[model samples]
Target: MIKIEQIFNKKDLELFSTEEKNILVNVILEKADVSKRERKLDIFLLSEDVLTEQILRKINQIISYYLPQTMSVSIHCDKLEGENKGQRLVTKAWKGLLQCLFTEIPACRIWMLNSRWELKKDCLNIYLEPSGIEFLKGHKICSIIENYFIKLGYPLKVVFQEKTEAETYDVYEEEREIIESILKENEFRNTETNINALSPNIIGRIISGNPVPIGNSIKGTGEIILSGEIFDVKKRELKNKTTMLTFGLTDYTGSVAVKIFLSGEKKSLEYRFKEGLWLKIRGKIEKNRYTQEYEVIPFDVNINEKLERMDTNPEKRVELHLHTRYSSLDALCSPTEVLKIAKKWGHKTVAFTDHGVLQAFPEIYKASKKIGIKPIYGLEAYIFDDESPVMILPPDKPIKDVTFVVVDIETTGLCFDDDEIIEIGAVKILNYEIVDRFSGFIKPKRPIPTNIINLTGITNETVKSAPPIERVLPAFMEFLDDGVFVAHNAEFDAGFIRREASRLGISFDNKILDTLALSRIVFFKLKNHRLNTLAKELNIKMGSHHRAVDDANTDAHILQELLSRINEVGISNLSQINDIYQLRKGVNNLNSYHATILVKNSTG
Candidate 1:
């Protein structure tokens, strides 16, 4: 079935989609044999069971796209199966990962090209040059890379390993030495008295004026004094036999490029103009003609190494609200690293209120629990509640006397004719307390979709050992009792149950109460009424979101909270609860706020 020629023919393939690149990343170069004119490679990849046939085809296509034309290439793809597949993907993808890194972060260049990486057990051990390690540690870059791959749909770790002597290389040696020997043959007299004499004291006298911060220096800021550390230095030889040394300078406020033409200097700026060295310069900001960008030209340079410091206040401060990578452009830090830093900084508790979604909670839970910090789950939700309330209640009964059955269900799929119910969970509440519970899994006719299996962790094997929906539904219907049919979204759960009952020619009718409707009116100030959002706001323990029992149990808890709020406002019965649904008119209801809600204890 595989087309061998198109794959083997040398086709220039510089373009690839994100998904295609990820295919390249999750492969290991098991073997590579290269001759003068040809190259052969053996790559290990996920088995066809783990990846679909379409995905496997795409992976082969990506292999063809990435291999160079210089060699007559042959690649043998070998499939890996079982538990070790994860480790294989992690270990093999490091080379392709650099490409992903560059695409995600523009500043992540080819500095890590020759670095060594391997996945041992769970951690991705990376061996980088010393400077590369410093840069990674400074920016907290490891977790970001890990999280990037996570969003690409796999879980892996990134940990920096000490570079052994064999693994180490001078990443900047070429840039520093290319124009170095030419500096010894100075056309002018030997200009150096002592390069070491150009210290802070002498440099202070040379300018004697406050240095303009590099970030604030604009083009045409003529002959101003500036101070910063050199970060990047590169040397380029021109056709005219002149040498150019360009280095990036930063003062923490901003950064700028400083250019120097090495025509007659006696000493190499490689000694002073190199990366990580601090310098004070008298330079004029001018636009470069070739690159068409503003840069600096130095008049005089001196060593000015400023002492580094950090504020180590040991006071424990509580971080109530923060955002993670889920908060759009607001935050990019991975929750794992951010929570770890919070614990390191003596914060015992923290909360993440990502914008309008509870999708980040799972990551927060896993990360914080690992680091011994309390995670107060919350969100900045979008609220738009202006719907009329639906109330079907016993006319004169007080709230305490009536029993409420809060029900939740998990299904094979959404359609009534096609999909069938797989699981049912229900909780009975009376006198504001959960009095009883019912839970069961029902086998469906069709196979469960892969996504549903992931979301609920329920498999065909799990239901195969259980009863069918025809048998399970009757018991669930009987468990509903004469109580009011209650659910988070009553239209879905109760309606689906009713639809199934109609097939059996059985009458299914109960006074239905929608907790979703109650939440909208009761918590009108909330951004939106998601189950997790309502749970976070009301401080209820939502056990597991997509599961039947957890959601139904949580719905019962929300009902109690809504009932309490209703009673405080003088609503005595279910009919009066609907009166609260009328919009709070004449007020500026259009405006909404990003609120900070927190969990008080472990249950939350």
Candidate 2:
């Protein structure tokens, strides 16, 4: 499927023509059951013609009828041109159709797979949970999905996987009242250590030690909170008289099989394991004794609560960069919850800027009006746009096209002239909130100095097997792509990267912003502008001071805070801010190295 971001951009319209747009509009009108006054329509079409640059204009034109002015229309098209197009479209359509069905169908449980649609000529592969399989077998669910595709001119050859023992079911409508009554009778005991009380890095640092990047296998206990949809659960009676249950949790990061062992009689708790439920769990992490594979043994879990409706107030200022729980492990707010909190804080306009993916858009859009807030939809995308370095959205518009990637690097020494980067970390921010992260460990030719190792906790042994800087530069630069380069002390980090890129025969020229410079201008009352100091002043969490990812994350938050302050002072446009900063250069002439000297004195 085309990325939602690509489809939303007005530039995508250039692909379609006037005639094609007219054809698409006429065809859609003839087929769709839409109200005359309906301002928004998201149409996903499978076209018979191969969509080339020549024909893309029509689709663009058709989509243009609903613009940011009147109503928002997002159209995604899959051309029925390739030999596998029919199968691919069928699979894609079913995945979405099944997700929609789960919302409407009662007593139905489905474990939506993260697997991409697998298409081979005429065959398409899909899988359903046991309840979903049974529901389909009895209710002609296949026919409903098939008919929807048929209307769009495609006959599907679906290869649904056979139901497995672990395929779970949901609480029946009859069972809900009973379970609710039982839960009401025995209220939850509040734990002293709630999620909010824990440090932001506790899961990654104290509990499990930085979350093993999803997909990499490891052994031993890893205490962490994983957020994902509960897809399946399998109950087994072990020879030792303990009941072992394994559940599948999936997120954009990946999937994991979490197993919990129950001793004594606790079968009543089984009802809590509902399919399609979104949960964040905290508990013991241990490796499977036999298999040596890792699994989380969750002791406590929190199911997300529904957001309450609130009245609107038009005078509230907009929060352009805010993240929801969907931003992997980095954020603690869900789309609805973020809006609810924003509403409680008296904000009328907020942006839903989840990293890379736009999965949060649908939920945020639905919750916006109910919560009395207007959501500006945008993404913190990672793209390489070197040729065109400057792209800013108009100040009066809802959003700017420009993106910023806040970066930080840890090196063997201070001076870029002689120092080598040991690690580089950055996060992409769109509309001001962190969306995606890039982390790479570089193996420098020189051994890391003892003082540097003591500071960064990166020993010479750490990067022994890691890729060299030259090998990592290409991908790192690619991830940097076409965004505005931002750093707390922009000159230090960006300058190092530029120096390295020059050595590697790569051109590295993207506009750079120094939060240090911006902070001195915005918060002139402060005696100093260090990342940790600014973070403390703004009340944003700083995980690890010297680490690349943590510093980058903090820098992103500081940038968000600065933007909020800047907007309040009547500076809204990125271009305008850049121009002002150009005039304000040397006002403080601060560098991170200077701040580090102060930090050393304090520590000493």
Candidate 3:
């Protein structure tokens, strides 16, 4: 008989391989505690039914690896079995409620609420982790959960435990303050900044153009789109009598004045261009040589057409670097809005790389999971390095932190056994700023699949001229050499890179950092730690969510910030970061070459 003792902490689980992590996730309480009195391991499980033959086998395997000399293992399972039918019904209802909540909110945000429950008399007590208590008070989230359960016939009370020292000391506070200051100085307020997004339908600006402002000089010609009511019509009594028509126009942005000149036979337009009659004029703007002011000269004029100003939505572009409301004051949109726009545009995956935080992940993951959209989690981090100028390292000099490379890969599918890497995106960071970037799409041995094409917005025509993975991998390897490898899910990217490098007879064992895991440690209060959620919470903006360079760059920013906090916790080296991240050392099980196979079979 195998006995299980003690639960595995979150930190303990970090050291396990991906396969081991998956197995541990299924086990109750995970990790058996060693009992000195019994001289055996004791495992605490949530339910007796969880101890299946497969789980037992894995458990034995783990025990053998850790405690080879042990004879008998003790398994302790505590469950609420043999309950009355009413109690069972209530339990089922409670479970259903929890699932609904998880769907609505990220599990990370409400991890505390997901804790085990106890029934005493008529009151059902729901216990939460200490990290959840603060959000509970400010948001009344507990009452929301309690009222929800109560409506379903179970009266409940919520309880919070004492916080640990780790939970109390937020190492990212200083970094966040710095980021907040940077955002205030840098991020553009969404105002009348749409010149780049101006409609293509508008008449070329050069005709109705004004002198362009360059430094203090009025240089070249520019155009204007003006709409308003005609205020006055005058025949300028000059050497050559000129017809002048002046009108006022107003849009949501502001108001503008327009002028139109009609000559000879066109002077008949003055009759119809009466006062209070609204019209739109498309024209060139020129500086009045006398008054030294800019005014429009009409190229085209329309009668009674209401030219309502439109906010341009430039060709359904995906912003891999984006910030939502979660990035504190740094961002403005919500996760729902971001997801809704993404889905509407048929984007398969969207990423969230927040400023050194993962509080936004839960909402993005939960929202996207059911909708068949993948949410890529990333971070804009800050890193700290030794200030010494010399490159030579003595024992006391400490290993100088040099470069961090954030990487993202897009593949044909998930199974690495057969899947081919189609694209690679990476960003190089030095001193907390992105100094360089790398991106390329590889032509796989097989044709690109329809689903992948849809998922990544990369079509067959896209990779036709590109080189294969073998040719591209070498360049990428050279670019990534000796730098700390960072990715949202470092295991997936690192696994793929490691296996691909192995195939090429190249060796790579760069220190790795998983933003996914780091977020869990730093933003423990967050219920969900997905990239988008973190972006929203931390006010980090995303440029293009899933695309390689954008995701990598965003994650690079996150890395810099995280390194700042990591250093604060006395972790100054890549090895220490790797220790916390527990970098996975196995190949990812992604589906291989589906598109290539399909195309070949069809052709044959």
Q: Compute the lDDT for candidate 2.
A: 0.62
Query: By the lDDT metric, which is better: model 1 or model 2?
Result: 1
lDDT of 3 by residue, 389-436 (tens): 111121221224467788999888899799988899999876667788
Q: Is candidate 1 or candidate 3 better by lDDT?
A: 1
lDDT of 3 at 293: 45
lDDT of each: 0.68, 0.62, 0.58
Q: What is the C-alpha RMSD of each candidate to the true structure, in Å?
A: 18.9, 25.2, 31.9
Output the number of the lDDT-best candidate: 1
Top candidate, metric TM-score: 1
For model 1, the superposed segments whose C-alpha errors exceed 4 Å read 1-387, 392-396, 414-417, 582-604
Please write out the lDDT profile of model 1 over residues 1-604, one tens digit for every residue.
1122223323312344455444544443433555654455444433323444555555456554454332444445666666777665554554456656666664645446536566776677877767678777676679777875574346677888766554323324233432343333232223544434345432112555678766666656467788888887876554444556778888888888886656533224445566888888775677643233577766556677674533277776766678888888888878898787777677777778888778888998888778998888887765544444557544567888888899999997777667788899999999888899999999887777767887988877688789887888888878887888898878888778998899887678888898887776667687778899999997888887899989999988999888888788888786676777553442233335556666565554
Reference-based TM-score of each model: 0.41, 0.32, 0.31
Candidate 2, 453-524: lDDT as tens digits: 879888766888989998888888898897788898687888889899999999898777778777876776
lDDT of 3: 0.58
